[model samples]
Target: MASPADDKESTPLLFSPKGGGHLDPANNGVSDGPRRRAAPPPQPLETHYFASKFDPPQIAKVSTNSSKYRSENLATPIVKKIYSSYSIIKDAIQPMTKPSLADEKRQGKIYYEDTYNDLPWRCSCGTHHKDGIWLNHSDKAGLVMSSLVWLMIVYAGFTVTLLVNNNSLPSHVGVIYCTLCALALASHAKTALTDPGSIPKRAIPNEDNASDPTVKFCNLCETYKPPKSHHCRICDRCISGMDHHCPWMNNCIGTANLKHFFLFLIYVWTASAYALVIFGMNYFLCNSEECIFPTGLVALVRLMTFMCVGALIFTSNMLMSVFWGIMTGMGTIDRMKKQEDKTFDESEEEPMAFTDIFGIGSYFTWFLPIDPIFNDYDSVMGYSNAERLQRERSTLV
Candidate 1:
């Protein structure tokens, strides 16, 4: 029943390979399957490329914000290497400082030799000492003797005054008083004049650093002396309450002699007062006796001279006695008191030895062991006035 045209249209076409040719599905009006992607052209070989044309893929632009990059660049090993290298180089170039022995020897010898003969005493390092202050043991002894004499003179004068004022007073009383006073004066004088040279030597340790400021160890005397003791620089021995070296006495006033000095002060004061009183009484009592030196005008002049001199001596002696007594009492009290609040230089690492400051006991026996003040001769005695001036000059140079 179907026409030829309909039949032809409904029939499917099938292409067959003829003469070794492939079939074309699109030309036969049948849709072809998915087309295959075209193959890309072959890439050029990398080895044959120019070195400058490609920049090694630009190294992928890494960011330091990453912990991995930070650790790698800033390793502890590199930091430690820098530090050690600096220390080694610095140590290699550092200069060494050392002590100077030549300077020490020179200074020590100079100070020792110059000061040896002047124990307990010091020269006025200046011109003022052409006539020095004589405060030696002998002088102290003499002062004590003078004081005793003064006591006798005062008692004698007082007795005479009492006899004149009280008619009932016995004459024998005056004689007894005068005799006792004379004995006391003579005893003091004898004690004071004792030879200091024969006294035993005692070395004094450094008092400032000692356990007891009131007591010191003496190497020469081989004993500990009472407080306020100093070795006489002149005698090369220790003295108690030794104020200073006395060129006049040429000996140290040790504890053995200190009592005499005080007694002397007492006696001197008494004698001075007695002299004044006697002078005044005699002036009135013998006014009409021609006031004779040997007689008449000569005697009057002599009497006047005696009175004037006696009055002056009395006043001066009295003042000195009072002052000395007060000072000694105060000093004694001070010695009894314990010192608190000790201070020292923070900058100093070590203190000088006792012998070094006080000197060797053998040569500078004021202390127990004659010791140099310091082995460091350059710093010995500190900066003397001369040395200070020298330093000032060197600054300009």
Candidate 2:
């Protein structure tokens, strides 16, 4: 027999059908010849195309950007004066604050640097307070708005009823309608008077308080603001757990007074509906009772006025309440959809929940103006009942 090395050298190499290359089994099936691959097809123009970042020749292009630059750099004395005048207009309109906001700021300044208790000095910064003059701040504005709504409600239901629909209804029903209307007004007034909730002014961060949670800075307020607080354009101060500003209430709806706000909405809506029924009865009596309508231009004017009141009230409050309900229902769903659309970092605040709207399971309390057991800021700040109890116990211990 031949030696193993000679035998291996003499062994015939296998041929591969791929372009007739000699396959080397010993070389793990690699080709002995220089490998050839099919030439790649040419790429389309799109593949080769690229946008050039270089600007066109300066003489060739007169860009809109240049005009923007020119306008921004306009700093003549006349322009400065014009800008100053515009700024005054802007200051007059932008971010209307609570009445005597300057005095409020002074109070906050006194307590802004709470040393021992890092918790919000809510009395100093919170919206709920009775110290100011009667019907000032949110109260004054709300009073005006509520007064308007009440006047409409009363005029539509009670006054119009007295004029036209009153005789049609029994005494007790009329009394009930009047009472409901009055209660709605009272609820609205209470909602206005109540403080929604305010964010405490934060302690100035320094060597000692740099790491404190309550040392947040508000760019708008030019001071430290607490967590879960934001500046209200209407209130012109930071509100704690603020939901939104209601022009109808002329106030910010926030943590402390949302209960009252919800109650006001419900009562007003009910009152509006009751008024609508009264108006409907007047129309029904006009058509059904075959009653002789009041004669003379003055009486005729009163009749027309009653009809208009009913129609207007129906449009403003009844339909408006329906629209409000739709809007309110959509709010949470929209927030959830937006949350789904966004990819937030770990640090961002969460989207407001349906539960945050004040009612899901507890309809009784939600329908009325009564406060829930967990409606306070402590609860709003994500404190679970168990966690709160545990923290309390720990503090005691």
Candidate 3:
């Protein structure tokens, strides 16, 4: 039996519905304190690759760090794409191999500097000329034939000239005809006798490297040759400014002898034509009595007889001379054009044909031996002389 005041005071305070911490899905707010976390379930070990970017890709165990925190993310999709692409190329490319020590040692071994540098530059001329150096040259027979051919042409021209007005033309004509014949004979003799430029006998120092653009060494002759030079089978030596072997001239057509060579053709052809015309005119213009006026009747008859026999030979020779001149002219023009174009233009794609350069412009320089001029041109003849110096300078650059 407690009094009313004590009973009221002892009763617990009742909370309002709005202010109370009630358990209702709709009305309960999130708690400020951290919620309890459950223990994670055991996860199965997954395969992975571990490689440094600097090393070759390889199969590797899952690294401790990678496995510890890796979760289901986009990395697996990216890795799958990489593997699919890489698989296509893997078979084509082999694993890189390391070089062995023995291989490296052999490659790095050294020897005497000039031991390998002395091998002769091989040439195709070896087959044509078996005789080495100056022993047993093959051009002796050609030389004799060449001399005889020249003499025959001179004799024919002289006979016609003498028979023409007792071997004397009116006024300056005789002098001119005689001068022409003499020059023709002299030119032929000089061309046949002169040595077409030969390579120096001394070995070119350090001339082993074929890739060296400035110098070309001839292994056949064991000497150095300049550009546009070749070994002659008959001459058994390296000839500079090599044009071609002419059995008729009994010598190689080369740079130094070209002046006389080209002139020889002009004189020979003109002499033959001139003789034929004079002989025919005299035969047609005069009757039998006046025809033998200069020489005795017997000598005149003999001269006429010789002319009949040799007419075919002279005609054939003149025609051959013409053909050779045309070919040589074309070749020279072609060479000049190449040099000219090479000096000015560097972007040329197709090479000009050796024959295509023969045209009206080239005809002007046909008789002139302009090799001297072109030899000095911006070095078009591939290290002949100045070109060597030019190449050397370019290497430094």
Strongest candidate by TM-score: 2
Give a tens-digit lDDT track for model 1, residues 80-100: 899999988878766332224
In candidate 2, what are the lDDT values of residues 51-71, reduced to their tens digit?
333332444555657976566
Which runs in model 2 stand beyond 4 Å of their true positions? 1-143, 160-166, 202-216, 220-228, 284-377, 381-397
CA-only RMSD, every prediction: 29.9, 26.7, 26.5
Q: lDDT values of the candidates?
A: 0.40, 0.51, 0.51
The per-residue C-alpha lDDT of model 1 at residue 122 equals 48
How far off is residue 262 in model 3, in Å? 1.4
| Candidate that beats the other on lDDT, 1 or 2, i.e. the better one | 2
TM-score of each: 0.30, 0.45, 0.43
Task: Show where candidate 3 strays beyond 4 Å.
Answer: 1-138, 164-172, 201-217, 225-228, 287-289, 293-397
Error of 1 at 235 (Å): 3.5
The segments of candidate 1 whose C-alpha lies over 4 angstroms from its true place after superposition are 1-181, 193-226, 243-254, 285-397
Model 3, TM vs. native: 0.43
**Alpha carbon lDDT at 275, candidate 3:** 56
Name the lDDT value of residue 164 in candidate 3. Answer: 57
